[model samples]
Target: MIFQNRSRCRENKSIFRAGNQVLQHTHEYTYLGLKLSSTGNFNLAVNELKAKAMRVFYMIKNTIRHEIPIQTWLKILQAIIEPIALYGSEIWGPLKTQDFSKWKKEAIETLHTQICKSILKVNRATPNNSCRAELGQHPLLINIQKRAVKFYQHLKRSDPSSYQAEALRCQEQNRPRSTLSQLMLKLQPDQHSTIWPNQIIQLQKLNDITYWKDATKSQKKMELYLNLKRDYKPAEYLSCVKEHKVRKTLTRYRLSAHCLAVERGRHRQRWQPRERDCVCVCVCVCVCVCVCVCVCVCVCERERERVSECPLSGCRERTAPAEVAAERERLCVCVCVCVCVCVCVCVCVCVCV
Candidate 1:
């Protein structure tokens, strides 16, 4: 008898139900170390895998041999990181969306920026491809693809009378290529779609007798893909380098902008008070913004994504070199009020007693 280890992350009885009724229902269950959600998406499993990989990577990095050779570290990664991160990858590998924007950025970011770069003793400035190449480690995405291809091959090679082969046949009838057609298309060396025509033909035959059996094709394809001459695609290479540059530039820009904003906010907070002040001299400056008859409503729209930025957008203080300041006398220690209104907006004025 086989025993499956139950995980603490197993799905629990439903706390909610439709039609304003509560029913004892379990939307998901854990079996064989996999978290299968009701939606049938690998999101939960993928998140778990990432958490496991990160924990294992850190554990090995610090607790174990402190100063291991790069090659040894690579071996350690393949042993621990791969098993954790790539478990059940064949099922959900191709299910990933092409758009990285919607992905859980933290999961991939930690893997790429921290684990992968630290493994190679490299920094974020290094190109992604260069980092993987220098480390002699396969890209996480590549390994997942290879697993998918292998699994497809296994399903094709299964017993003809088995349900697995029957399911493969059903999948073939529904689509010309496997579900991963788009993923494979992206991995194609050229922009042409017909490059993998033979693979497509075999997918059509998935329902029939498993005649096509070039099991090592995925490996060959990956090796060729990696070894392809990049000199021919100078523009693509430049674009990749430019992508890195853009990301770095954006990071620096955001940092400087954030620092300036924080400084301005601190200055504003220091000058301003929490309690409302009474302005005895309230100057109502209205610049006759299109006086309409019976309809005094005015519409003035400005496109600003971050309109709440500091120094107050409408009240930009500009003092030219030729401009002279008016002579002023210091007031005695007495209660006073100051109000200056401009551009149809009241400036918050305050005077200390």
Candidate 2:
């Protein structure tokens, strides 16, 4: 593949000969699963990664029940989806956060938030910040940054005479925006380091690279989780959930794969109204009819008492007719009241069941 501007690339006739055969020109190609584009950017690779991750995510989503614990879902995402999305990020991940690169970061963040919202069974309208806050998940860009750094560290620790180490040296000297240089600039040998955007953590001992990496990551995760809790308002669904129970469940699951998925499922179902109009209508109608019958009986007994206490001798003879008229009037009122009550109950159940 040729790396050039559109006009120049179109003008140039690119060909290659291997053995006795000639190779055709191509604008882009995939090497070791990374797509190299003539456009001189990893945009295509990032997009493909995002697409692949989403495809895997959908397959998981369809195959597994949403009733899975939040922690399990998170593990699935980190183990499966994130690996796909962050594949080869070591090469392209550390580009200075610019237009397309920044957008790619946001895109990955969006995917992470989407998965979080799904796991929590929250609405699509839930704010992304709140979603991340609720789940205690750091922005995915941070992971990409870490991957890039670890790869840089691996190269530095590798054989100096090796091709990869030599390339790293060349990039460090020539390319300021290269992954190695970027990691050097961000993670200087200091008391602390800034791994990604807005994240700062102490790195008192860089000699022990593995230990330092793990310590910094844990500290950053805790700090971010706390900051989010203190700053952002919880999602509507989250706010309605029992705070203590949620925290306990999340903590338990994070510590170990606990079988407390049903707790969250219960909370979600509580907030989610199931609108079965036929069932609600039947229930409300039965209730209203029973209530109205009780009221009608009371009214009819009162009418009978009034008729029996009549001062006229003909009142006794007229009791049957009077009772019939009163019964008719009361039945009309009872039916009207029952209908009104049933309609109101039905609407309430439909909206807030």
Candidate 3:
């Protein structure tokens, strides 16, 4: 199949022969596990890779419980899944031009983030940057680009007489839209500069892998710390937690990914408040009522869902009964100005904070 931008040659029927037999012209072909199409579009190939990677990802996720350490999970992901997803990234990596490259990169990013969330036993709502920072993991795109850059470096350092080196030179000279050309454009090499620094060395210090990894992680963590400081929000609990480990746990709690959050969700799922007997029952039936300064009455019933408007003019906000079961419940009356507390009943506890 022809790999050109235009399909004018396709209109004319062409035939090829190999010895005594006729060679078939197929629209698509898979060679060395990488799919190639007549239109030269890499989207299909990327989709295939993502599908394979996801299958493996799920298998691993199901196989390994959260009992494993974060470092071990990271190792499994980087070793098993990344290789599958980024199999031919070195070849198609440069094709990721901004507006045209959303799905290609997003798929990999999603996989990486999901794995990270699973590793931390965090909720899906956690911010991607926070997860990456917590785990000290670089973005998957960086890894893919690094692979591409290293591949280029390898080709550059190959024997000049080798076909790969010859092809590299030829492509640089003739093919402006080629992978090498695109990578060079992205890199923005200086024309006036003669002496080229080793891309491999400049990209990362590989002589000591452990040191390099640690340094990279530290850099990432420092950047995250600076970002957090810039966007700081004072929390009461944070002031009390002086230990670094305790602060880390508090940060996770703030992000809604801590064990408390998980347990809260589980509790909500298990004990659903009846809609009819909802404490903030705006309409009719009295489920449970507590005679306090700020009275919260809930009439919770099975499979009932409706919005409960506050009868009191003081309480402008209206809450759903289903939400009262799933989330927090607020009082319709003016009980307290600033302080909010949780109330545990005889059967079910309506936790509001």
Candidate 4:
């Protein structure tokens, strides 16, 4: 018995109906066989069962479905199905007993080998080609390379435990090597610092040597502070040198020392006061004072002139000069004559009485 293909049968209703009828008949016959098996029709029952099994097989064949790909399925199925196929007979037998420990050990070993091989393959396949041809040709690369060599030598001398023997061996073998500067140029900015600190130091040293020649006095001082700060943490180094009690004193000393140096440098250099500025301030003050003095003098002169021009006697009308003089003399003489008359009257009265 064969099941009809869905695609081929879809276009023909008669074919689809015929396939459905066949499936129904197979189910009915299989059910009838189960019902009749208790009766004496054992041969007929066996034939019906075979027919139903054939129908199920045909259905599966025509399905063409997959959960896993064929290759993966074969590999996985070999592990699962092989054991079961080999042990199926023993598994059902009353005398046979299962041993899971042996099977588990075999499976673990197989998985471990597979995992290790996969990791090694992945590691081997990673590309290590560099894109630093231009960097290799740089002029500074040689100097940086020398410095890196020296730094590595220092590291080896200072602490052999910290330096990897393999890396040091590689450096010794590869002489006339390109400096880390070239390598750093190929790396990201953040990666450069972590990858090549010694190279960075050499580059900075080169810059400083050049800067010392051309930098101004103030710039040199600033560079000194920057270098110190870069090499040592300000708070930690200061704390180490001076205890808490003397921290402020140390800080003041440092600040005063720097300030004095700056002041001394300024003193050594020629610095003239701005003449225009000084003259402007002096002229402004002089103009203000002169204006105030002129105003005061004018006020005093005006008051003096007003007082000198004021008439003294309010009763005097317009009078001739000679008449004024004669009146003045007559008034004086009359005052004298009255005083004598009073005196004589008093004497005569006294004598006659």
Best-performing candidate as measured by lDDT: 2
Model 1 misplaced regions, further than 4 Å: 1-23, 98-113, 121-130, 176-353
lDDT of 3 by residue, 40-110 (tens): 87777887898898899789788865454455667788899899989898887677642212532476677
What's the lDDT of the predicted structure labeled candidate 1? Answer: 0.49
Cα lDDT of model 2 by residue, 1-353, tens digit: 67876673374565678988987777789999988887788878888887888899999889975355556677898799999988887778776362222432465667777787667655564444445656556566566666666776688789999999988888877755475575556555452543532232223112223332333345422443344344323333343445646754553343222444432343364443345656676787788678877877777786666666665535576435675577668767876786688678767865554
Worst 10 residues of 2 by lDDT: 200-209
Report each candidate's C-alpha RMSD, comma-separated, in the order given: 20.4, 11.4, 16.4, 40.2
Each model's TM-score, in the order given? 0.44, 0.57, 0.55, 0.21
Error of 1 at 321 (Å): 60
- For residues 1-353, what per-residue lDDT tens digits would candidate 1 score against the true structure? 11224556655543766688876655566767778776566678878888888888887778865455555667777787888888887777878743332332535434744575675443454344334433433335545666676676688679999998998788767654566555554554354534444464344334111211222223332233234422212223323433544533433332222234432354354443333233222322222122221122211111122232333556545431221221111111111122112322433222221
Candidate 1 residue 103 C-alpha distance from true site, Å: 8.9
User: Stretches of candidate 2 above 4 Å error?
Assistant: 8-11, 96-105, 175-179, 189-353
Per-residue error for 302 in candidate 1, Å, reads 70
All models: lDDT?
0.49, 0.62, 0.59, 0.36
lDDT of 3: 0.59
